[model samples]
Target chain A: MDEKQFRDYLSSYTDAEKALSAPMRDTIRINTLKIPKKEFMGVSGLKMEPTFYENGFYADAGPGVRLGATWEYFLGYMHTQTLSSMAPALVLNPGERDIVLDAAASPGSKTSHMSMLMNNKGAILANDVNWERGSALFSNIARLGVLNAKVTVRDATRLGINAYFTKALVDAPCSSLSQPYAYKKFTPNLSYEISKTQIKMLFSSYDALAEGGELVYSTCTYEKGENEEAIKLLLEKRGSASLQPLGVEFPHEPGLSEYGKEFRKVARVYPQHFSSEGFFIAKLKKGSA
Target chain B: MSHVTTFREYLQRQFGAEVPKEIVLNEQEGVIRAYSKTLMMLKPSGYMGFVAGKVSTRGIEVKSEFAQLLRNPSRNVLALDEAQAKAFVESESVAIAEQGEGLRIAKFGRHVLGVGILKAGSLHPDFIGKGRKRVENSINP
Candidate 1:
């Protein structure tokens, strides 16, 4: 999808066009497990504002200071992540005692976040299919002082685990349409193929979830085929799962209701509207057998 | 494997730090690793594939990747000031004010950057590893 083509598809062409070229804000989330938020904020030369999430902040990175290179980051006291990417973990809200599964965790931004949320108390099965990325996941997990997580190299759709998890996070792989340069490579066939894999991953995630468990499915794409349609297919195939409303307060539009009433309960974030990257998130609950 | 006792004895002789009872050390392909007992459960389920650290021929050396998991360090510690810490993290050796040392933890403020070595009254930051360059650049800048 070219800029013109994408603009024509948007609800407001002018705002969307402007947002596509807008500068992305630098945001960081304080790792409370490592350092207190107040003390980290006291570091000199940092000017920031509270993000939608309490632990996150939108900061003006000083000249020549790479946020990733800071001492605080080295200590794993903070993580450089986009505000939109931080939502899925916030929504999942894993507890200290819950056994959780990060079905497609790699490079471990969300997995580490879940670890902090869990206070490194329970077990987290962090899996990624790619070996190279799995190494990065392990490194990040270790750097962040995350002990409860176990790194695994396996396709999430075929994870042969005998035990069920109380909660799961599926930030499924999707077409990178939300990225500024992604539209150049966008194709109908590619989108269709990704949607199919996404649907399969969703089913697998639901299968691994224990009864009364909650799963948060999210993606960084604006394509309905890969977002709502995939969830609709999962609901149709799995009789034991249902979609639930997300009660968290964040800037977002309702998911396309044309798909279904339950789909409307899902949240859609557009870069133009939220001043962040495009994203879709839906909360799911596995009913008792 | 066969070197488990040797490795334990090495740690005791060199650093005077006891290998904790809860830490299970396993050797694979000539590399020894230390892991918590809980990791055993994940190993049986095939959920964990990576080891925490490696024990070298010299002594039980912790891999940089798992350095954060080391709750206790050998008494040899050198605290660096902001300037010295930045210089040390840039992979540059910096002069230390307080004398004597061997393997020391390089700390900047409250954050532990990793391990460093002190020889000839100068601290070598090679232990910061390749991954920690980002921290050096950001904090030092």
Candidate 2:
């Protein structure tokens, strides 16, 4: 809302490097299993670093680099995914034969990564609402040599409640507030007007996930109103689901109580802390087995 | 399932030929299972969805789309216009060669999807595993 509140809003973040400059574009993960590290270097001719936690290579999208049309990418060997974006899939740990759904998968970075991690052994339904976006998702999945994936064009909120999945990933569409370039008016105070759609899609994700199934809800935004508060409300509607803790060593900022009890297990990554975009993640296990 | 038969009939009328009886049409799931000496999976639009990931003594593991096509290859070839049929046949030939025999062909249909040289005359199906060196013909053929 204001600079003071913005400072206080991020006060809990331990690595509040208030002086740091914002990055122009986010990092991307190159699928190294198909394109080996050595070959990736040769093709992009760019220095690459692997994220410590996942099998993805990160490159700065700053200077004269066209990542999409390159040979490595056209062959379906790489996806532009953020480091923190990889966390929820790891948290979900979907297995082969398990039915997985990615509710908001467009330009499919995490969806392709999950398919490979599953070793192309399970069914992954990657759904996106927009026709153009869904087509883009399908193209990326095809380029990756994925055989066990299916694409659907539908409003994720309308994916029937009758369906069940071993695991679900809802990278819900949220306010891009955490992006440094977001207009000042996008803050949580404006949540009433802008966040309504996100709130609806998030609940729809929970409805689509089956009993005893696990859903990892994630958003790139850092605000409690969108992340923790949404989880808290969803937990209230579906009491059977509860939050699970993250094992990765990440910093926990203080005074974020606006999200209530559910915030304890939720994980947040700040731009200052992870050298990446701000992200919020929470893992919820559905009905007990 | 009736959608498959209706679609098959419509195709037969359009092409003026008897559709193959073994075609298993599944329009509801948006997939088709076609069975012959080999299995083919097909989508409603007659596109090959997948090929058999495995070969079996009993039945082949047809992909979702080709499994639908195997039952009525004629209806499929006829489903497209002469130009499209020719293109489909060429593309399918390449896909089948590459997938079933590990032979990459430079052209499929009118467009070229890759630059694989055709194997010397009468390329043995046995040469399929040559794409990967570690694979040896240890299994009795």
Candidate 3:
């Protein structure tokens, strides 16, 4: 692989490299399932500024407050998550009546967020392929008071539940190159290799999705193969898959547009744009071919 | 439904709450759990659900997992001030005046901390939570 060419892709966006190493404030979301927003804020006794996302705030814990060890956290009143990571679920927008599939849910930040979005009224099939990670997923799910999810431990690509989910989320694990010094952990050789497995997860997400159902494919990496090209391949093989505009009103650039291909509907959030990690999000609809 | 009937009778008799009509209650090996009824249609695995309580000859002993779900119960509650609540989570037992025979839900102000035992007016914390690791009970940013 042309490692230099792959690294050069960041030149397409402003401050992409600078954004990579930016330090960000601790951001947390009030778990409204456990406590109301206003009530949480009142009891938190910490100074906080609201972020762009709903029920999210950029928190300043001051001197002694360990957000993780606090009674509020233990009681499932709040969760720590990045602003960029929170967008995919907001765009997916699983409602109170939707049967959603969180295809790669673990440590369950998105799954718990989806439950909060649903007001804990809908069903979520939260699955992760690894048993080890699945335990952490349930821990978060339990800690957040998420009663609407059915946790499953299985190979996501082998999941053959067809047309059962009204909406599905595939927050596929990537090289995490968006983080500062993350490239040292994952070499460039793994870019396409990782996307290969990502495509399988996508196929499973598409399969489980009901026709005309919304699918949100997201990754924290900026690899084109994992980002745009994989979706391009999916549209080619599965003729019913079509990209839809992601309705996130945040600081982000549109998906890479090159050659004669048009990927204008997809969105890429640069870390510098929002002082959060980089993310690539695409909204798609599954339909009958 | 006779699913965990004893647990059901215990909840109603103790908290004056019916475990919410929308929740599905299940018991296995004497431990009662609760989950969203709609999600169970998927026949989910790892539905350990929330560990509401365990059933025995004395009826049900509430688990800390069910503390937040209860608003306020009419009977069998052990109230603690902020200082005692902090000390209790660290596996400390506080002396008391009222002689309750068994366990009661421990509360700090409006927040329900977990289950505690009251024997001969000595309140013992039976917490199954982060405090088990000797956590710094401060609210960190």
Candidate 4:
């Protein structure tokens, strides 16, 4: 809120930790499914670097070019996303025809990434509580050339669909405290007391997941209440789901706070610490439904 | 792709505005589909799913929001009567309406479709499917 309050809230994090809060330059990944990478390079005058463990490319452009208005973007060859943000969907490791759930998916960046990872073979249910965002989600799905997903506008808690998913991404909305680093208008104070809703949303999302399914609980906030605490609460409620250690060379060191004794296995990411946004990703496997 | 190219050419010949270069076209069955965003821009990829098929001369299948634009092309000026609305929908004539924000056109389609444009001068995104039936049903029912 104010400068002193912002510093007090950020007091727990060191200067290096505070640096991770800055947002990286806007980057987009070029999808090769519809159009080749070369065509995208030619049209946008942007070069590409290989993505982390995916076929998509990392571009050196910003969103100002109206990339979406171009015929190339409309053709589904390119998608605007961040480098670090794309990790959760790839980590889910969904198989063909496996149903998936993207809880709190809006302005869908990760949900579409998951579909491309699945090669658009199976069904993905992208649910968001906000009705205003429902159509925008649909518009993105259609534009990306993804055929396997279905859109549903319902509160995250009322997601009583009969289908069971092999994987789910609960990218719950957090305090968005990490946004300040990415954009000037955002600050650490943004997430304070704002994560309570996200905790409730994540709890409802876990209820919709299935046995033997993998769930990647993620948030972009630096707060313990929304991150590990929420996962800890859900694990306690659903007793069958357990935290699985992440093996990937994640960009940050672990969080000092533990949601539960079992969540010691949880993996935490900080933007200043990880060269990306302040993110927390905890992988949970449903041993029983 | 063939059908999409053909359809694009036809639309360009009919309507002077050459469909922007980056909008991708997909053809499946007899319909032609156009999209404004890319696969990656789609966050929740399955959120809205995919288009049912291609756009046909009979009628194009669009989302409800897009359909609203096709039904009432006039931005804020509600036509005097159904006849005016019908004329707007039946003819692709662009009637400029200075509404709340700025100037936008009211476009008419084959069926009694009308749509309001914001500052962008582009059709609303979800203008597809049985927009006429929905608009009329909203009035009658």
Report per-candidate DockQ: 0.36, 0.04, 0.42, 0.11
lDDT of 1 by residue, A6-28 (tens): 76655442356666766678888
The list of candidate 2 runs beyond 4 A from truth reads A1-16, A19-26, A32-45, A60-63, A185-190, A249-255, A258-262, B1-141
Candidate 4 CAPRI category: incorrect
For model 3, the docking class works out as: acceptable
Residue by residue across B7-126, what tens digits does model 1's lDDT show? 666555544556556556667556665544544544324334234444665655544444444455565555678778777766778887767866666666555666666777887764
Cα lDDT of model 4 by residue, A167-203, tens digit: 7888887666666633334444554455667766666
Candidate 2 differs from the real structure by a C-alpha RMSD in angstroms, to one decimal, of 11.9
lDDT of 3 by residue, A57-89 (tens): 887666776666566766788888888889999
TM-score of chain B of each: 0.61, 0.26, 0.79, 0.38
Lowest-sum lDDT 10-residue window in model 2 chain B: B132-141
RMSD of every prediction? 3.6, 11.9, 3.3, 12.5
RMSD of 4: 12.5
Please give the C-alpha DockQ score of model 1: 0.36
Which segments of model 1 are wrong by more than 4 Å?
A12-23, B1-52, B63-74, B95-101, B126-132, B135-141
Best by lDDT: 3
Give TM-scores for every candidate, taking all chains together and pairing residue i with residue i. 0.86, 0.64, 0.89, 0.64
Model 4 chain A weakest lDDT span, ten residues long? A66-75
